[model samples]
Target: MRVRGDDLVKDLKKLRKGRGILTSSIISHVGPALGEADCPLSDRELEILRMVEEDRTATDIAYALHLSAGTVRNYISSAMTKLDARNRAHAVRIARDQGWI
Candidate 1:
């Protein structure tokens, strides 16, 4: 079975957290590296934004991602709010500029 990158990352984080002292030591050394790797937007937000960058409609993106169109729109709206974008196009542009997608 194929696990998504987001799921794998979350699983690794869970495993690291279970290690207590080791995780703390690693976090101390890792510092900003971990912070930088953490996306300001959630995985679903990034995925939908990237699709927008490809000029896909909300319906198209929803179909591709196996989500409802409304759900996809909500994610896009949330991403726009987080990025302070004027619209979906602007959000995609900002995300691309930040290398978020």
Candidate 2:
């Protein structure tokens, strides 16, 4: 199950050529042995979740980001759905645990 260093480098080169960004995409080079296969949250979702982790309310986040409170709530909801989290607190915990925020 050990991959040679040269093989790993070659795989990485191929991956870099085929896929420019690693975000929102799974890298099969290492496979499931690394952990979960996908990161579904977008950058906006991560940003909102980071604010949530800091105990910021949707309204507070909205003011800080110059977005509507409803928009902030929507971002939190989207992140929660992606993370399969039950609430804002849960979403924060999941994101933190996964090192996504």
Candidate 3:
């Protein structure tokens, strides 16, 4: 059966409430690199990066953005390559350093 969006939201809220903890590691990790110097990010790339900064999983981002996980992965990979980043964490750091996200 298909679940409605409201139902999904309610379920998510319930799960979050059960967890009873809101962490702040995402900002902490990306804060230092917020301003340095590098290339600029496009609007779509920035959106994807922001979602990444929010600590959302690739699968979650894909679902939220109505994209295939493969597509999300490709965007991430392309971003990483353009930034000459070694990995996801490095890409985020580079993007933040460039003031792209």
Candidate closest to the true structure, highest lDDT? 2
Model 2, 19-96: lDDT tens digits are 534422123335356775556789999999998988889999999999999999999988877765678898787666
Q: Candidate 3 residues 47-98, lDDT tens each?
A: 8878888999999999999999898888888777666567777778767754
List TM-score per model, in order: 0.61, 0.64, 0.59
The runs of at least 3 residues in candidate 1 whose Cα sits more than 4 Å from the true structure, single-residue gaps closed, are 1-38
What is the C-alpha lDDT profile of model 1 across 1-101, one tens digit per residue?
A: 23466755565587677843322223223534657434468988998888898899999998998999999999999987776567888777766755677
Query: Candidate 2 — worst ten consecutive residues by lDDT sum?
Result: 20-29
Q: How accurate is candidate 3 locally (lDDT)?
A: 0.66
Better of 1 and 2 by lDDT: 2
Q: Which ten residues in a row are the worst by lDDT in model 1?
A: 20-29
lDDT assessment of candidate 1 = 0.71
| lDDT score for candidate 2 against the true structure | 0.73
lDDT of 3 at 35: 43
Clashes of each: 0, 0, 0
How does model 1 score by TM-score? 0.61
